[model samples]
Target chain A: MADHAAHALEPNPTARAFCLTSAFWFAVATTAGLWAAGYLIAPDFMANIAYLQFGRLRPIHVNLVLFGFVTPGLLAAAFYYVPRLTRTELFSQRLGVLTAWLWNLTVTVGIVSLSLGFSQGREYAELVWPVDMLVVLVFALVGVNLIMTVHRRREPVLYVSIWYVFAAVVLTALTYALGNVIWRPDTGALLGIPDAILLWFYGHNIFGLLLTPLSLGVAYYVIPIVTRNPLYSHTLSLLGFWSLLVVYTHIGTHHLLQVPVPTWLKVVAIVDSIAMVIPVMAFLINIWYTARGKLGEIHADIAGKFIFTGTIWYFFVSIQGSVMALPQVQRITHFNNWTVGHAHIGVLGFAGMIALGGMYFILPKLSGKPLYSRFLADLQYWLVLIGITGFLVILTTVGLIQGNAWFNGETVYRVLPEIHLYYVLRLSAGLAILSGAYIGLYNMVRTLFFNPGVQA
Target chain B: MIQRMTPTAVILGAVAILSAVVFVVIIWPNTTVDMTPSEIFRERTAEEAAGRKLYIANGCVYCHSQSIRAFDWGHGATRIAQAGDYVQDEPILLGSARTGVDLSQEGGEHPDDWHMAHFINPRWTRPNSIMPPFEHLGMENLRLLTRYIQSLGMQAADKRMQRQAFWKQASTKAYEAGIEANVRWLSETVPQGWRDIPTPYAASDYSLARGRMIYQGFCIGCHGPVGDGMGDAQPHIYPPPLNFTILKGRGISGGLIYYQVMNGITGTAMPYFKKELESQKIWDVGNFIAAYFIDELDANGPPRGIDAAYEP
Candidate 1:
């Protein structure tokens, strides 16, 4: 642990910028989510505002969470550790900081355009063409800087964390272009049923190729260092990496299980969805074993607590996801709040938790100062934990009521009143998450720029 | 050997595997899936096409699904969605969430005026709906959106619209003729056998209580709280919601009320509640309307059928 703490005293401007970016967007994204939840409980609370309507607000909240909040949080830690693992300085801090600026610009443009009603009408791919181009461009810049840093490294063997960061940036760039159909600038889509097929393929990969790998990268780096242990097994890392890419890439069709897509495609999706256990287990066993009998150390560090809890969420979400892919289970789960709960578990519970952990892990190191307030950090952790767990139980219950009622031939309108109370509960739970986001934002900003604590 | 992985090997291997999956899952399916139009498929008019743009712009697809599945029991379940049905859709609008009902077969479900009221404020027609109102889109945009919505089922929607158009003319003519004529036309429209049947269930305290709940959810939006037909949606609807008091001393039967509420009066703003309300609910609300508004209590009178097992 002492050796791990022996790092360069120089300031990491790139990492600082990204940490600020992530904190700012997490607050903004959660606010948008809370506002959208308010609409579900009382649609006429602030009615007739076209831009703030539920339909528009939904995409804004989702895109900001994916692109603005979680991705940048993970990347902040990646910026800190990538150079350290390679035994070199970052190739270009200037380029990395510029990438961060461009990333913010892209997110700003995405939010404004979506609010002004200029979406591409595809989930996770809703950015208009110009913003989509900007997304690809910013990703390319990050890719170049990271790859160049690796090129200049003195270390001969690449660490597993390095592999994940590289794959996430490069693979995402390719998938974003393909999914958005960048070739067709006017519509950014294929026609008809094929378009649905292609959109979901890219949609699922946003998690599969991007957030999962980046979050895992942070976990692989922090868990070992925090626990003062070497990785449990290189063999498991190899298997997990390759199998995640192989299995996650094609199983996107599971989203289209009940749609009119061909049966062969659905079969492959269901089979591979169940096959996801191989990669998920391999990664978990590797991380958990490395942290074995060191639960005290993990709880002692705020970063470890967050990331360790994230791994548990990853376990629950993956198991739930595999079950949701089955035809029989999907009969009740699809097209309802059940899937919404599942998404919150995966994004907020798994990736978002890890992303926050990653940011907390690197803030002190980058600033050469301890955190501004450890108490605040722990508070944010519990708030987010309670919020997400409440969401799971409340949303899953509402979903069951809806799915069963619909299957029983009740009209959609007939079920609205029955579920009204749950939406109210969901809104109250969301308040906890919204407050957590603001607290985190304050903590991160103070740690980065205004900490009064003595330098380590 | 896997431990000896290089940066080049990792990047190249990921891209290679992604390309293979893309070909098998996306690109291959793009080429092979048949684009043939379905039997009900028809090209959209220019207005409808323009309205579709507004639909996309406003993000209406988030709440309303355009795809109808085989097992669905709600709106648009009459026809299972087909791949061929979406041949012309640029980015198919098969929404993932059903925050509102499916709109695939919603085109002719109500007249244009109903949509206007709904778009202006969904609660004006559906008090229980949680959908955000699009009144900010302006009246002109709402008309265009209405056009697009009415074109959802294509040829099938066209047929329903024709039926609506025909009945709308007749109902309007009868309404303009006189209140007495309109009441006669409404009663006459019911089958003779139905008009002869009286209300079977007594308007017990419990039954009216249940009836009141259902009314607040499904009817008060248009029928008004006191059954005066002066609900918030009254101004927008032509041949406005019927005043239930007008049926008193005019030979209104419980069966006639049941038939009208179950199968909505098409061509006007009235919608069929058959998909939403069950038999017991329909009966209870009918008796409630007859006893309270019409001041005619034929329920549990002479010629009553055998009592239900649960009834005292």
Candidate 2:
């Protein structure tokens, strides 16, 4: 425990900048989430308003949450941890700061363009071609920095986190280009059934490759240190890492189970989606074991607490994701609020929470001062936790109602009344998350700039 | 000093326990849902069987679910799917998404010609369907695909197909009787009360905006950028697309338009948007058509003094 505490006290300006930038985007993403939630509840609330309509705002919210909030927060941690794990200073602090600025600029462009209805109309890959290219470029730059750091490492043993961070960045760069079909500037799609298959393969991978691995990497790093214990088994962590790469890479086809792709492809997807249990459980075991009987320690550190809770959500989401992949279950879950709920859970509840934890854990270490407001940080945590949980319950119930009604041969109008309240509840929860984002932004800014003459 | 499970061991054990619980609680039952597709689909003629193969091959089942449950009636559901419906179906084709509407009871919904046009390019018939064109399938295979899609609901589909066959015979006769008779026949399908009522809402800018919004969200997907009813989803709809201009100077009533939009023209890809859009949106869209394409305004008389916010 003392050694872990000692390790956390070192100051690094690169880490400070990363944390500050992450906080800014987190605030933006949650605000978009709240706006979209409000639109869902009262379609008329901002109807006819150009920037706030559900058609435009939903994509903005989704993209912002993915790129603006969660991605940046995770990368901020990676920027700090990757170098430390390798026992090497970052290859270029100036380049790292430049990447953060460019990344924020790209996300800002995406949010504005999407709000103005300039989307390409694909879920998750909604960014226009220019922004998509920018994202790829950003990934390439991050890759160069991280890989170079690895090359210059003082330590010989490359940890599992290093593997995941590199895989996520490189795979995302390749898949984003392919899935966006960036070459076809006109429709951004293939001609027929091939298009649908290609699109969802990219769509599902956004969750599988980008968010999933990044969140797991952060979890692996945070849990052991907080518990003041050695990793139970490096072997298990490595096994889990490789299995995730194999299983998650191919399971994107699960999204096409209902489409007219090859039956053989569907078979592979279903099998692998089920087999996701192997990697998912392996990682969970490794992390939870690292924190065994250390609940007290985790609770005392706000970052550990958030990261631990995120693991619990990963359990719910991956399990639910596996079931939803089944054709039978998908019969009721697809094209309704059910999948939407899963999207929020996986994106906001799982990845979003972990990113915040990473930011919190690194903040004081980089700044050489305690957090500006522990009370406010804790408040933000509770608010987001409640908000996301509420969203899950409300959206799931609405999805089930819509699914069952559609299956029963009832008219769509007859089911609207039943699900109306759930939408309203989701909107209320979004408000909580939105406020939390603002609170986090304020606390982070204060910690970065306001020089209080006290050190804990 | 306290001794507890090492971090690594604890994480591994937690993983094992959770995995076992997931396998037991979720996966086991999913695998056991009596999903032997072959067992359910045993009794079919060679043609229906052929049609089934096409359904599977084209991925028609991907966008359409053959199963109708008790709670589905709110979406203008016709019949609840039964286990008996699947008695002769092998590898039951209960699809996962509703990109296109459900087809459990699609057997006799439309005439063969409508299906032909729809299979060729759904937008020709339904202006808002996202269903892709099957023109590459050529005329014969298109007909075969139509047969399969029409037969999705089994016995119920058979009943509906019978009605379509009956109507086709009469409608063809009426058409052969020339323009006057055909127009009369179309108008006669409407009840007397609907024939007389003009639109309740007057033509206004707000109405046009509301109409435009609904058009973009629902109609524009199928109907083209203009009101020619040539939307992108048209390629998969049948009976060819409705040329809204065809309704021009035809004395189409607001009530008639409302009814068709609300209930959808049965056996066509023009889905009832009653669930997705509210009553006001339908009325506004109808008015947009009347004013812009048809150059007719039935709401020319004194304005109804109803509350301004009334949706229907």
Candidate 3:
């Protein structure tokens, strides 16, 4: 097990800090999401609060979930797994700890700035220049810490998990700088149609390049360990990793297919979008097969349960994503809540479940103790599951109603009353998610700091 | 043979692929998209630019898209969005959602007063709107915002603004020229073919109930519950919503009301409902206004068309 006395005593302060960061922000992000949902059904609930407007609140919810909650949660697991898998301590725990604090500071600054109306006004790229710089800086720092750790490894051949972590950190550092247009500090954007082309390219990659790779890294490491099985195939892992990088990078223009972007760009986006099934199925087949006939083991562990469920959602979201990029399908789904539903399935249901799973998987190991409470974790799992399911069903229904009505020539205003009932239903779903986030925060906080569980 | 991967190889390979993708996807397009201004494009004034900042600041782009597609049937649907039209927009607010309608052609759709009422509280002008109130932006900011909004379609918006300006002057002059002159002007504007055409449907109890529902949803915000033009938005609207009772002795015809409702009084807060409501709904609401507000009825009057099988 490579359980040297020196390794046994190492505290992994960075992973602990990130665990707290992820749990704390998950609560805040969901609360913001619930507030945004409230504004949809009752626009007057917090009327005229400039910062609390639906526009501002929606972006805040999105950015926090992407950066503050899911990314850190996934990274928490990465920080722990990288060192252990390499048969060495982290290159510098002090720098890793500093990165965690700086990450928190950056997210805090983002919230305050967005509330004060200092946005750069681009979706997913709304953090103005300075905040954008901070985001880039953190990605670079994470890349350095991980890469240097790999350099000092006692192990010779890199595991698939290590490959994914390296790609996620290094590639994201490059994409973050390019997508945010860091060179154009004043506007942090390009001019006109090109700007839109660039914004969405960057936006889609925040999920594709950053969250997806990091989440997969954790899955690759956690699944085999928990299920006590070797990976089903090395070839499948190689194919999946390479295909994901090749296909996912250029599909951003699918967002602008209905807009005035070049027809050729749309074609590239559509074809590659459909081709995404290659990487998606490859990864799924590898993971699902490795855990084959091991349902009881997965059920016995909360982390395994969450990650295995996440794979199912990954299958759904990827297939849905491919189909949605088709022009005929997008004719009905584009620019509506259908896209919102799709985003939730990908981010919250797939990546978010994995992030939480990864954090839970590593928490006890990092602390040298058993989990604080399995019951609380299970309760949170159901709440989030129920909430996301409600979101998927209700939001997809609303989008269909809106799309058909608009196609039939009904004004956007006329369709509002028709969807009011659905919005109310969606709000109820959001409440479940909000409750789940708080419950997760409480469980994680107790396990990290105050748990009385016996040391394993 | 087992392919071995080192940390440097993984990181370098991924970055190299990303750089190649960037060149093809982003950089190639950067040099190619025709940036020449479109027929309707124009530069924004400083005030309008400031208002665009406010729009971005408030995240209006989240709900209201600036890009209009070819198949769109709502406002700004007259012209499809063009690449050149966005030449001057930095960060390009081609918003992703349509919780509200597109604003690509919103300029001069209504006069300044309508926006005043709308910005203060959207529900004041649009009874069923889910759009959040921007009253927090205050009066002056709203004015600057109105300028930006009124410039949405650029040259196309300028043309609409000219039409609105001409009508505003004429409508105001007629309104001040006393009651008789105003009613004459209102009816005279309708073509001879439409002025005397009686509403095809009879004013049945069933029809009136439907009419009442439509009025509450579409008109009660601006026309008030009692049809006195004293609705919540009245203070913000100039020349005010018409007092329906004044039309009682003026021989107000169903055709005049229907035509006005279908096409709308462009210079006023009344938007054309043809895109939103069908012919039956427009007739139903018009009949309801005549019976309940003006104390008159023109449905099934002289020269009435043959009764439909569904009529009671």
Candidate 4:
């Protein structure tokens, strides 16, 4: 831990900008989440306020967490580590900073557009065409910078993390274009079932291809460094990486199991969804083995504590995903809060936590200062963990009550009364996450621009 | 495994793998979705199209599911969703959750008047509904929304709407004729055997309480508080709600009330309670109406062998 505290260097402005962008948007994203949760507790609470309605707030929260918070937080760490691993300066810091600014602008416009009800109204692909174009452009800029750095590598062996970072940026650019249907900006869709298939392909990949890879990259890099160990096995790491790319892309249609998509496609999705265990386990075993005897060391470093916890969440979330994807299981899980619970676990508990871990891991190095306050970082971690865990429990329980009741032939309106209490609990849980976001914003701002902690 | 691979191998290989998956999973499925319209599918009217835009804008899809499956018990196992049913939809609104009821076969389930009262405040129609009121969209948008919702079942909805329209004209004539003719029109609709059968349940306090709860949830929007047929839905409905006060001294039987409540009075604002309320509830509510509004209760008259705690 003191190794990072010993560094006295000029600030890496690009990474700092990204870190700030992430920290600022995490606050915004979680506030939108709390607002959405509040609506479930009482629909009429803000019923008259069109701008603050659940419909608008849901897409805003989802987009912000995907773009504004989690992705940027992971990218901040990627920007810092990719260059260091390549044994070179970033190919272009100025371009990297430009991309960060554009990224923020894109997210801001996306949020503002969604709030004003100008969204295309697809799940995850809700950003209207203009914002969609901005997203693709930002990803392209990121691709140029990161791929260029990889091209200029001093080391011949491209580390697994480098492979992941490059894949995430490049694949996302394509996926976003194809998913949002950029050609026909009028509706941002193909026709009917095809559109659902495409939307979910992009949707699941936004997590699988983008967040999963990026978060895995951060874990691969940070775990070894913090634990003071070489990767347990590079062979296993590459296997995990390849398997994830092959298996993760087609599982998006697991979202459409209840709908009338092609049976063959659903088979592919369900089979591949179950097969995701291969890569997930491979990565987990690699990380856990790398930290075999370094448990105390991981605990001592705040970054390791977060990343390690994230890996555990990754294990739980991945297992849950594979289970939920089965057609029989989906009978009880599909089209309800179970999937919502699954999303919270996957995005917030696993990827978002890892993104925060990555940001915290690189913040000291990027700013050439120790974290502004270790205690605040620890507090934010606990708050986020408790909040997300509570959400998973409350939401899953509600989903079960709902799924089983409806399956038993009860009416939709009748079940709402039975599950009303869980909505209240979920809102209370949301308060903790909202507070965590604010704490993260303050901690990140202080670390970047006004650190009172030691520089060396 | 990747130790010997060059950067190009890694990047190109990853993109290639992703493209293959996209083609297999997404692109190919486009050819499989039958674009030809099913018999039930139809192009939306201008008013419905405008209303659909509001539906998307207001995010009504967040809660209501537009499709019903064969395996589904929801929307009362209506026609299982067919792919071609959504052929005319640009971006289909087959929402996931049944946060409200499935609106696939929802068109003529209730009259336009029921929708207005319900949209103004969902609690008016469903006491336990968590749906936020769409009153903010104003009257015009609400009508537009009703058009879109009424069009959900497409050609199927039009058929139902047509039946409603025909009945509306007939019921209006009967209503204008006089109280004597209106009750006769309403009661005569019940089949012979059903009209002879008395309600199995007594009007006990528990039964009336249950009945009142049921009425508040399903009937109050169109039937009004005192059952005078002056509900919030009266203006939008053509023939309007039935005034229970007219049934007094007309020898209105429990069977007449039960049949009307269960099957609904066609062409009027009265919706069927069969799917929403259970058998005991139908009988209890009918008994409650007979006792209070019609100033009569013949449910206790005959065939009292099995008490109606939970009527089959």
Candidate 3 lDDT over A274-346, as tens digits, reads: 9999999999999999999998989998999898888889999999999999999998898899999999989
Model 1: which docking level applies? medium
**Number of the candidate with higher DockQ, 1 or 4:** 1
Query: B53-81 in candidate 3: lDDT tens per residue?
Result: 88988888999999988878443278899
iRMS value of model 2? 12.6
| Candidate 2 residue-wise lDDT at A377 | 90
Quick one: how many clashes does candidate 3 have?
0
Worst 10 residues of 4 chain A by lDDT: A1-10
- TM-score of each model, paired residue for residue: 0.99, 0.65, 0.98, 0.95
In candidate 1, residue A65 scores what lDDT? 93
Give the per-residue lDDT of model 4 (tens digit) for B48-109: 99988888887777788876766686536778888788776767777767667788888876
Docking level for model 3: medium
lDDT by residue for model 1 over A285-360, one digit each (tens)?
A: 9999999999998999899999999999999999999999999999889888999999999999999999999999
- lDDT accuracy of residue A453 in candidate 1: 75
Q: What DockQ does each candidate score versus the true complex, computed on alpha carbons?
A: 0.75, 0.07, 0.76, 0.60
Estimate, for each residue in A98-156, the C-alpha lDDT of model 2 and write its tens digit: 88888888988988877665666556776778998899998898888888888888876
State the lDDT at B57 in candidate 4: 80
Q: Which stretches of candidate 2 lie over 4 Å from their true place?
A: A6-11, A451-453, B1-312
Candidate 1 TM-score, true structure as reference? 0.99
Which ten residues in a row are the worst by lDDT in model 1 chain A?
Answer: A1-10
